[model samples]
Target chain A: MTATDRQATGATWLRRNRQVVAPVLFLLPGLLFFLVYVLLPVAQSVQISFFRWDGLGEPDYVGLANYRELAGDRAFEVSVINNVKWLLLYLLAIPGGLFIALFLNQTVTGIRLYKSLFFFPFVISQVVVGLVFTWFYDPTFGLLNAILGAVGLGPVNVLGDPALATYGIIVAGLWPQVAYCMILYLTGLNAVDPEQVEAARLDGAKGWRMLWYVILPQLRPATFIAFVVTIIGALRSFDLISVMTNGGPFGSTRVLSFYMFEKALGEYGFRMGYGAAIAVVLFLIMLVFIAYFLWSMWRQERGA
Target chain B: MKTAWTTTAALALLAALPATAQDESLSGTLTIFSDMSNPAPRAVMEDMAARFDEMHPDLEVELTIIEREAYKTQIRNFLTANPPDVANWYAANRMRPYIEAGLFEDVSDLWAEPEIAENLASTKSALTVDDKQWGVPYTYYQWGVFYRADIYEEHGLEEPADWEGLKSNCQTLLDAGTKCFAIGTKFLWTAGGWFDYINMRTNGYDFHMQLTNGQVPWTDERVRTTFANWRELIDMGAFIDNHQSYSWQEALPFMVNGDAAAYLMGNFAVAPMREAGLTDDQLGFYQFPLIDPDLPMAEDAPTDTFHIPSGAENKEAARAFLRFVVSPENQTLINGGDALGQLPVNAASEVDEDKFLEEGFEMLSANAPGGIAQFFDRDAPAEMASVAMEGFQEFMVFPDNLDDILGRLEQARQRIY
Candidate 1:
């Protein structure tokens, strides 16, 4: 609050600005690209939901009609319910990944290679993942059936059965998601504050409580990132659904995004307006979590 | 340093110039986009491209094959920016939308070139929209019941001639502990084939025309009766369980193994089954068992056609390509592929005596009935086809709800225009 502090702060700002301004100019291209590609399309997609048009034709204003249809659409309702199931179940990957990461975090021979090998599923394309799982779930020639036969159980049509089809796809989706979370946790574990762990060990703190009190708190940022990515992955799920079942068995496995695509461009119809309406609902559901995350980040920034 | 640099530069320029010069010719580049990735189709297309280059000696043809399921979205995107000069497209309803958009070139002039128009008569109907032909016909296939001759022989049965015969045959097959029919409705289009044939047989030609044109109500008793017939087969436990997960190709093994008696599929299925080791003598072809013998028979076959895009850089070359495709020599090569199982669209184009195609030719050629029932999905717009096919699947599974399903289709019909 003093005149000397103000003068010193002013001097500091001027000196920093002289150095920072050039870097800011250098940063402009990437920032502009991010705004254009990411931010602008999102805004436009929200705006487009109010109108009706096939991609080729002129769009007509149809306030709330698309939304009204979406609300009444039994398929959309089913899809939204499936998406909720995906979001809830997808979080299991974090703990599963954390355990795998911790198990492999030690400095053993070829451990670095082991960690990379563990992350292989994450590196493979989702299409390939979907194909692999589809084969695994194939009622006749799949690994699941072969194993079940050995156990004297009958063959179960996993993907063909409407009730089990979504779960089958979800299991396939989880394979890569778990690998992704493992990588995040491995990186987080590398930065875990070994000095505090050693200090706590000297005080006879060894197991879950010691880890919870000291090591876990330090892994918050990594856990937060993992949680956010997993949630987003669940919400944005489409490729596996498209590849595996294609929302078959009487459209049992349709998630919201795929349902939106079906509404718009699928053989079903080019109900682009209705698709946009479904998309807007998905976006709003996502917005609640995004807003909470943003608010949390903003509070942290303010506190810092 | 300057002398050494100049010598190296001269050598590099000399090395590159011939290749660059060779690249700058019309005969040097040929690009294709297609959605036929079945191994046979892919091999056939590539071989044709290589052969074309060999004949031209200058133009290099590059072929790109995409999976069928992804073709529509990929084609839509490609057309938005740089449409490929040539691509595979369906004959009727699918082509009509793109043609209306001026996305396809009117190859009517090419059609007039005597060699083509006279050759591909059956397919020309599918390719032409509003009196202008948009594409050249490559292949047209007949849809019917492909049965196991051996199985029928073992069970003391013959190819069904009418509804009663079909029902009796089903009972005979079921009593033998063999699945009566092997159907895979996973794509939903397979069921459309069943619907198209059944409706064609049940209501005859005029009724089908009226139903497809959206002039007649789907809930009309004629259509309901078709559902009733389909439900009888379903209730008898004749179809394979989990039929929804199996593609037509995947279901062939069941028929070949005697797990099923017959497959209601297009003629194209024969090649794959033959490749899988079934012989000409083992397979039997039949008209879909007639729902009503007195109601005249109509062929429910589909044609595959090719159209040039509107903005093709080489217009004359594109026309020449169309003319070449429809040429008698080329149509014969196309039919000769054998794996294609299609009758050449042109009358003069000879059948290869490839057993299955011969059978298709005989069955398809007979009867002074109406025009071909262009595969249901192709005859109907894509949106309506998907809805109706799904409705058909539901009706097959839940026959009592025919009224509700048809009523729903009536609502969907209202939205098309």
Candidate 2:
């Protein structure tokens, strides 16, 4: 065919399939990235879990050995338990954020300043937050001990004690997470329908009754996002544990992510396959929540 | 004037001939990856590179100094994917993984040379695995009980001679409201130091080596005896409270402020203690007390080394660089008081006149007839060291948890080895 005929046919095809082609063309980069960076890595990690590799030499097939080892691994047990503590305590940030958002939502002078002040922790780096909390909980001369001393209580070494170290790190993690959730709630609060609130007020809905029945229902999207982010944040907690205690005081503060890093990339760790195993376990745990989140979103979209 | 110019030019040519002849074939870029990121060490590294570059005028020396902690993980990546001509690493089992993987070049021929054979003999075993030397030691520092001499004098304690004497001295310090040792196990490796010394002293260097080598079980009777010895100190509250929260540097304040009487640490602690205003009169060094006097004393003196990667393109230049690094002259210069402030690896190298270096040198050379260990973490496999150190930390915090900790370590030992 002539060049003009070929061009004319290509133009006609483009016009015919623009609807499907345009979206795919736009999504090509993102879809490629998602496949290469995320999906491929996840699959690779799962595959690696079945091998015995030190990241230096050839990988030997180990089958279920790594998983079997994890079953009896005390450090792995501690990390799983700490992760549970983190998950439960980390959810507290949602409510804490709601309360802070409520407290700061009022129309008052310098409200912007107050909101920013409350948002300050989220703006700061996680490492800084971890370091700040670490010093705050220092046994020797930390602000925590000084306050305890003032209140006639004995000095408590929070990070040093195995029982308390994980909780201490979770609390540090909560500081910024609560701020993040608060920002989401604050934005959600802004979009709340004032007309419905007025109708509720006319119907005698106020205070706790208005909040639970009227305001909270409007904040559903905010709460959902908060829950999703908080859950992911709790599972992926590494920087706080790393900076504050380094999964120390006998590996009490290790979450699966940090433990995975310790096994794969830490100074003493080159157990790539074992680390991949830990990563696989974490991925499976996350998958349950991810599936739930997706299903919920799908249902919500359909209902809308 | 003409005669004088010719004579001077001839003298310069004669002086340059020896160096240029030796390095005549070295022409390509020699890439070096060093973990000497600290300011002084970085300067020393840069100077050494410059000097090596000057010696071989045609060769280009490319030195990359990575942060020390980051280097630990980065070494694995670079050694495999993009290997350098030479790299810095610790000796002993720290090099074992790389050696076993055939990444590090076997430098046994360097050790066979008369100069290296005689002068660097002390550290030869540290660089050896499977009867082959893989690297050359650059510097090492002694580990001992750094203490407050003034406090010891006040308490009439004269550097304990035996385990009983050590315990008595500790008791004396404890009675005086001072913790006997200031240690931070937050990083976990500090606890390894204690385990090394106590195990080395309680059993012997050979037994300690066996335990670290994974030949002996973690739950072995000898291992328990070592922990039993360590438990005595823990039970006595010899260590500082909440040490698990502090780093090795943070624990320094306890010793500096006289809250703790002593610290069982490497010679590097001397610099910080001195910086913290502990004068020579206040600070003192003593070999770890004799636990089994019948057995000779072994000391933990971790040696830092340089190795040629097996995949290096310019190994001839790398080999020459390694020789220059360990040569008595360069060892002396690099490990001088103002430089690394550590003990020179070459025996022929003159030690700096610093008091701690002198004492450490004397102790390591003459007194430690048993053996010289490369610290607990260095001597043991990385995974095993990490697991055992964590156990050590747990033991320090809760002496009652020894049985559980040992069981966990035993499991790790089996899995790792």
Candidate 3:
């Protein structure tokens, strides 16, 4: 064919296929990234979990050995239990945030200043938060002990005691987390229908009744987001634990994420297969929440 | 442009000097990845690289000093994908994984050289794995009781000669409202130093070696005996309170402020204590008091080392760099009081006249008749060392939890070994 004739044919084909081609072209980069960065690594992690490897030399297929070892591993048990504690205790931030939001949702002088002041914790890095709380809970000279001593109470060694270490770290985590949830609720409260509040007020609904029946339902989207973020934060609590206690006072502060790192890439940790196994277990735990979240969001979209 | 001019200048200088036969033959880029990121050690490493660069007219020496903590994890990455000609690492089981993976060059020939074979004999076994040497030791430090002499004198207590004497002194110190030892178990390895000294003293060096080598059960009665010895100090509250919350560095203020009388630590502790203003008269060094009179004394002397990656392109340049690192002259210069402030691996090298360095040298060489061990983490496989150190920390905190801790450790031993 002549060049012009071939070009005309190609242009005609492109014109016809533009609708399908354009969207796919637009999606290709993101899809390629998701596949390579997220999906491939996840698949590789699952595959590696079934092997015996130390990040050096060839990996040996060990069937279910790494998982089996995790089942019996005491450190793994402590990590799983601590992860649960983090999940349950971390949820406290949701209500804590809601209360702070309600209190701050006022038409007062410098309300913006108050809101920013309340949101301050979220602005700081988790590392700095961990360090600040570490000093705050210091047994000898910490503010916690200083306050306790004023009341004729204890000079409790919070982080030094395995029983108390995780709780102390959770408190540190909650500071920033509560601030995050507060910001979400503040945004959600702004979108709440004022006419519904007026209607509730005319119906003699106020305080507990108004909040329970009228306000809370309007805050559902924010609550859902808060729950999702809080759950994920609890599951991936590595930095605070690493910074504050480093899974210490004898590994009492370790969560699944921290344990996975300790087994895989920590100073002494090179058990790649075992680390991958822990990652798989953590992924499964997170999967349940993620699947639920996705389903709920899908149902809501359909309902709307 | 600056580098080119310096290279030219260095080449001209090398030509002027009577060049050694080996020096003329070495021509390539020598890359060194070092974890000597501390102020003094970083200077020493940079100086070494510059000197090495200057000595070889045609060879280009490149040095990267990673932060000490970061280098531990990053070494695994670079060794596999982008191997340097020479790299820094610790001795003993710390290097085992790299050796087994064949990432580290078998430098048995370097060890066979008379200069290394004769002078670096003390740390040879530490760098050996599977009957082959993998690296050369450059520096190490003695681990012992770094005590407050003023406090000892105030209490009229002499340096303890045996376990009984040590206990009595601790009792005296405690009675005087001072904690005996200021150790921070927060990092876990500080407790490992305590375990090493007690175990080495109680069961002798051979048993300590076998246990670390994973040939003995954690529940072995001999191990229990070691714990019982450690327990005496724990029960008496010899350690500072809330030690688990402090790092080794954080715990120092206790000794400096006289809240604690001493610390069981490496010679590196001396510099910090001095900086904290403990004069030589106030500060003292003593071999960890003998626990078992008949066992003969063994000591913990963690050796830091250098190795050429097996994947290195310029093995010859790397070997020459390693040789230069361990030569008596360089060893003395780099390990001087102002440099690493640690003992030189080369016996022929002069020990820095710093009080702690001299005392550490004398103890490691003349007094430690039984043997020398790399500290707990270096001697034991990484996984086991971490697990065992955690157990040690727990045991210190809750002495009553000894049985439970030992049971968990035994389980780990079964799994790990």
- Candidate of highest TM-score: 2
Best-to-worst lDDT order: 2, 3, 1
User: Candidate 1 residues B1-417, lDDT tens each?
Assistant: 999867655654554464322222234465778777887777767776665555444456777899987887777667657776677888878777778767888888887776666666667777878999888867788888888899899888988878889989899888879998888776788889888888888888678867877778777888888888888888998887777777777777788888998998887787777888888788888877667778778888778777788866665555555665666666777767554547777778788877668777877777526668787888887777877887776665566777878887887777664
For candidate 3, write residues B287-375 as lDDT tens digits.
98888789999999999999999999999989888998999989999999989999999998999889999999999999999999999
- Give all TM-scores, in the order shown: 0.84, 0.97, 0.96
- Compute the lDDT of residue B142 as modeled in candidate 3: 94
Q: Write the residue-wise lDDT of candidate 3 on A1-304 in tens digits.
A: 9999999999999999999999999999999999999999999999999999988789999999998888888889999999999999999999999999999999999999999999999998999999999999989889999999999996899999888899999999999999999999999999999999999999999999999999999999999999999999988899999999989989888999998998899999989999999999999999999999999999999999
Ranking by DockQ: 2, 3, 1
The sequence of per-residue lDDT tens digits that candidate 1 reaches over residues A133-201 is 988887778899999999999999888877888888888888999999999988998898889999999
lDDT, candidate 2, at B36? 98
Q: With candidate 1 superimposed using the best TM-score fit, by how many Å does residue B140's alpha carbon deviate from the native?
A: 0.8
Compute the lDDT of residue B221 as modeled in candidate 2: 94
Show where candidate 1 strays beyond 4 Å: A1-20, A60-63, A102-118, A149-154, A190-215, A265-273, B1-71, B77-87, B105-120, B312-320, B338-341, B394-407
DockQ for all candidate structures vs. native: 0.33, 0.92, 0.81
Where does candidate 3 chain B have its weakest 10-residue lDDT segment?
B16-25
